[model samples]
Target: MRCLLPLLLLLVAASVAKAADFAARFDDLVRTATPRQLYALLYDLPKGGDLHNHAGGSDRPEWMFEILTDPARNGGDAFYTRARFGPETEPAARYRLIRRRTYEQLAPAARAGYVPLADLSPAERIAWANAFRLDAPGEGRDEFFNVIWPRRGDLSQNLDARLELLVVNLQAFAAEGLAYLETQFGLDGLVTPDGRALTPAEAAPLIERRLAQPDVVATGVVVRFQDTVIRFRPDAEARLSEIYAFVAAHRDRWVGINMAGIESDPRGRPLRFLSTLRRLRAQHPTLSLSFHAGEMDGADSHVRDTLLLGASRLGHAVNLIKDPDTLLLLQQQQRVLVEINLISNRLLGYVPDLTQHPFPEYLRTGVPVCLNTDDRGMWDSNLTDEYFTAVTTYRLSWPEVVQLGRNSLARAFVQPEVKAKLLAAYETRIAAFEQKYGAGSPTISDALGKVEKVKPVTYGYAKRTWGLEFR
Candidate 1:
């Protein structure tokens, strides 16, 4: 037994040494690789899952434009945008970019201000595209929370458009090497082109049929959903109960419940839902909870309070560092995971200077953390951009990068068998990636040549932030 103990210790030490060596090599590559090469490598790197994604917010503007403008895909629905607001325009509608049913109800002057989405001039097209994202210099949380979602307007109510967007995301994520997605998707409030509302039961089958299509299956990405409720609504508790039941009933695809809203809203305080959550928990089978907590300008107990509401994961726990007790608890327990959205936080003004983000602190101190694209479409970014930001900003080592991917899958609210398969697949991919990029392999220039062939897709954020443009 004594001899075996020494051998085991020696084996562990060798494993640590090997990991450290790979990390050193990865650091060297990061230091030497140009912006473009680094981006390509990150883009090609295997990712585990996106746990904090929003279905509507994650749709790329260009993708949405293509789908919306196509009558065949959009169910013959015509959308109009307020290209130029008039004095008669309601204050709320002044900046709204698109409307469907409401366009006909507007006053003549207001109606005149709107032009069919397909009829927009060249400059209007650029403006419309820019309006969907936080691309301007001074745009922040108010512009995002207030204007961005409203701009979608009635387009968001279209069931076909939403389903098409999901397929687009699946293809995009697959291209970038993502293995799993747990998007926060809602089936409520959907309508046909003529504005006939559909029940959840009716909307769900359409989603199922679309997902079962050969194109969706070809992506090979495991997809699950969490139905979200705006936390600040007056009937949020009732809504939470309803969503809880809905998720339980639809456990085949929907696995969790999430509470999302602007964190600053006092009515959405985390503790307010504790009683309702406890009551619901007693009735329903265990459903995963991931609440948006600590995503505030000022720090408080929201992160801790959210844990009390039975959340196993916290979304945008940006201000979690402020609560010492909670931080310590997380570090020790290592039970809950924090979904970190770097670009989202920076663009939304939560962390204007990302160097000050608490993500590294959480990661280094033993709290489970994973990088995610919270609203990648609005940020005009992708999962690779998040990893690029983390690596360059934090100088993460190779082992750290691998750990992040492992953490994401480990913490995902997925079936046990699915999780095991994903983890195994991730390990295999990581091993192959390491072999491809390891020492004594192709020269960096050769790597760059191969990466250029891949023709990775980039957007405004990539070009603006890192001066990288792969088109």
Candidate 2:
């Protein structure tokens, strides 16, 4: 026993030394590497999944424009962006991308005011596209919550467009080494390019077929849907019941339901649907719930109430840091995972300074957390950027990075058998990654190729702040 104890202590000491050495090496790289070099390393890192994604918000403005302007693609449908000139309208007013079908249906005078995106001059197109993103300094909550969606109108409801965007996202995420994606997609309200509504029954087979395509299959990313309902709508309860029922029936493709939209709106209070959820649970209890809570800056018990609503995960629990008791509960219980979207939070004006964010605190306090791209396309960023932000901003240890990756899949709403397989695969992939890059590895550029070549998308934040010189 004495000899065994001594040997065990020696092995433990060696393991600790190895971990410390890796951390030191990683820290050195972070500190000394240029922006491009750091980006290469992160681009090559294996991210487990993105947990808080909004499907409608996951398309780049340019990509959307490509779809909208192509007559062959969008069933000959066209789109127009409202132009602003005089003092009467807001600058954001110039940014709305309206469907031509809807626009032409408007009064002739109203229709005359907008211009086809295709006919716009090159500079005009660029300016209109920029309006879809929060690239400008003054753009924030109002622009995102109010201006953007109203402009998108029925564009997101286009079934063919959404399916195509799904493939795009899967390919991009796969290139970045993300293996799973649980994004919010409503099952209803799908429309054809010509404006005919598609029943959920008709839409299901089409979506499944697209998902089974060769390119999507090649991405090797497991995709699951969450039936998302806006919480603040007057018919929220009815919508929640309908979506919950839909998810319950389509458990094979959909894993759960996510409640989102403006949290500060009184109509969307967490408790508003508690009884409805409880009633639904009585019938369809297995559906997972990962809700958007703690998003507001106001001091309130939304997080606690959301827990009472039975959320397995909390999306953007930014304000949880403000509620000491709820924070303590999260730390002590560790029952819920916090989906941290560092870039989205910053872009949305929730956390202006990344340093002041409570992500590291959540890690230290034993609350499970994972880095995610809440709306990567909208932010003009990706999974790599999220990891880069976390590492550079928080100085995360290698183990912390691995743990965050593990936590993402571990807390995912996938089936138990699939979860086990995902965890095992993650372990194997992480082991291989560490073996390649852990310590005494080649410089990032040598190890992972040039950053500009590796990263598929260039962030607007980078372009605005540092320019495109690095890329």
Point to the candidate with the largest lDDT: 1
| Per-residue accuracy of model 2 over 182-229 as CA lDDT, tens digit each | 999886677675778888778888889889989999999989889898
Which candidate ranks first by TM-score, i.e. highest? 1
lDDT of 1 by residue, 141-246 (tens): 8878887887778877888888889899999999999999999998768878887898888888888998999999999999999999999999999999888888
How high is each candidate's TM-score? Answer: 0.94, 0.91
Model 1, runs deviating above 4 Å:
1-21, 87-100, 105-107, 439-452
Tell me the spans in candidate 2 whose CA falls farther than 4 Å from its real position: 1-21, 84-86, 90-93, 439-456, 465-471
RMSD of model 1, in Å?
Answer: 2.9
When summed lDDT is taken over every stretch of 10 residues in candidate 2, the lowest stretch is 444-453
Q: Give the TM-score of candidate 2.
A: 0.91
Candidate 2 backbone collisions, by pair: none
